[model samples]
Target: MEEQRALRPPWALVRGAGDGSGWPWRSTLLLTVFVQVGSHFAAHGQEGGRAGLDAFARVLLVLACGQLLWRLRRPVPVVFGTAGVTALYLGAGYPYGPVFLAVAVACFSAVVAGHRRAAWAAVGLLWAVHLLVAHWLYRWLPPSGDSAASWGQEAVIAAWVAAIVALAELARVRREQWERERAERAEAARRRADEERLRIARELHDVLAHSISVIHVQAGVGLALLDSDPEQARTALTTIKSASKEALGEVRQVLDTLRTPGDAPRAPAPGLDRLPELVEQAASAGLTVHLEGEAPRLPPGADLAAFRIVQEALTNVVRHSGSRHARVRLDPGDRTSLRLCIDDDGPATGADAGGGGNGLAGMRERAAALGGTIEAGPRPDGGFRVLAVLPLRGEEEVDR
Candidate 1:
């Protein structure tokens, strides 16, 4: 039920009361009826000296209520107008009753519309005028032998006005808090969406870059040996077919994440267990991969980050480096972190080779998401080196 209300538009609670369109006919009619009918009962109970409900008194009540039709449209003026009309009715010695309802509603609307000072000023003006008429001016104003009102009665009236203003102020504060919360929720949702998009982009880049690089190298070998060595050409074609099929499967798995998010993947993600496959792929691409130290066991997130870091580093070497020899080394650092380094020998080919410079960036993002880091640059000796240090435990554990 709470979710349903949150999903609804902000104005659903108020309907169109604050839309500033046609008059709020239903509310206006209700107020008019309440004041007109309730005033007669109030006058009947008042002391004999007060004036009865005359036609002029009824007209003043109607006029005060009528100003409420424009309260949401021009709140400041409506509040003051209602206060002035009600003050006049009181000064005429008419018995006080539901007639103040109009002034309360107008002031409430004004404060809620961010015209708080104006609402307070109008209420203050009405209170001051009532005090003057009830005390100093009542002798000359109405009820031929009327006496000044008691100070205790004046105090009660002041308290009533304070209560109404306090209620309006409370409502205004709550509305602002609701609006602020809604904005924060909206911003958080957008940020989550942006992060999801980036995650999918990195997944696609890693899957396609390594596989396509293998296919590119294999296709070249097949074409070069097609006329001279048919058997070797067949082997190259076989490698191409295998590389393309694996790429498609990985791409499908990535897409499945988008299609049904939050579900376990149909196939487990690649990790250091697939290092041999990466080495074979590199060998097929005419690059020799020399595996050094064994990788330590890591959590799923860190495992995937480590695998991708290695894959992207190898892909960069196959595409950008002229040297065919490369080395991959793993360092189980102090039992808390897993570190891996990829190094290639000799000068770079200066070729981006269809990997749009996102390879290194993707690797870095993967490492960072796992509370790890990536360092990649040209080595002082020759070629390039990529070093990634990922925590052995989960991100939550690492934080602790």
Candidate 2:
């Protein structure tokens, strides 16, 4: 069968037989030929003692091999069918040859298809019947002069069946393991995609929220003062233009990362180096921000996280607080961490600006990603404050 399979055209061999079921038509046909031809030779050795290859024995052989055609699909039925047909052939005292190959192939298919009990039952039934025929029923079976077979031969047959089942079980286990690994890898990829989407969402929210708040305030200021003060209104218009343009550039930068992921950023990510820009944008929004303490140096991730936390906090104040005065205090703590505080002296405007928004959530996500913490709430002294503490080290180093 193997040789005949190798002789076929490579494409035909790969495509296999009928309906793309991978049915081994060529192999089964070759096996039938081998069994018949092999039985002819085996008959010569058992001449005059065992029954020669006759019409009935040939029918049995063909029946056994034909059942194998359905082995890959209906393995349970095929195994039983082949086992019964092979038992009939043996009981007729036909010459032993490759006729058993059909049963072995069927058993293997059944076992590997996860029908172990069916395969075992078929094998056991075949063995039990063979035992009854070779010992107790030999006097009434074919080849009249034959004696009962030795127990030693039955032991050999039992071992051969054990080997076939064992090999098939091993193959089944390996296939299951490969399938599980592939599923786990697919699940991991989906998780990473979800995380990337969330990170992008947070980035867009931070950029748009801060810039739009500045524009909203400046637009309101320019309208109120337009008739009374042309110069201040014009200044407010200029601030709006600057804030909108910077927002577009940063937004474009964030989008570029999505288009060409894993590539280096075209512009640097926003960091504490951009803190002055945040303060300036806030001032343009009619919120006077007082800065305190020199900024601490930090790894890029922590720096970006710090900046976004401050940005979102200020945006929240602009939209929700009635206070015109805000304070930003930086604390470089212990050479290992950097602390940030954004405070607005309030009576809040009674606006739930970020209650339905991602602003505060995004801020917390950023700080947590850096092994840091964020605290934001109404202060005891009538104000709102957002406090963040981020590790000064790289995220990978912190993970270790």
Maximum-lDDT candidate: 1
Summarize candidate 2's per-residue lDDT along 1-400 as a digit string, tens digits. 7675553433233222433456778777877889888888989988987898889988999999887777767889999999999999999998777888888888877876789999899999999999999999989888988998889988988898898778767766765776688689899999999989989999889888888888888888999999999999999999999999999999999999989999999989988888888888898888888889888878887888888888889888899999989898999879788889999999788665334477888988888877889998999999899999888887898768
Residue pair clashes in candidate 2: none
| Model 2 residue 206 lDDT score | 88
Q: Mind giving the per-residue lDDT tens digits that candidate 1 earns over 74-102?
A: 88999999999998999999998998889
Q: What is the Cα-based lDDT of residue 389 in candidate 1?
A: 86
Q: lDDT for every model?
A: 0.88, 0.84
Q: What are the RMSDs of all candidates, in order?
A: 2.8, 5.1
- Mark the regions of model 2 whose C-alpha exceeds 4 Å error after superposition: 1-50, 54-59, 352-355, 397-400
Candidate 1 segments whose C-alpha is farther than 4 A from its true place: 1-28, 47-49, 397-400
Most accurate candidate by TM-score? 1
- Candidate 2 matches the true fold with a TM-score of 0.85
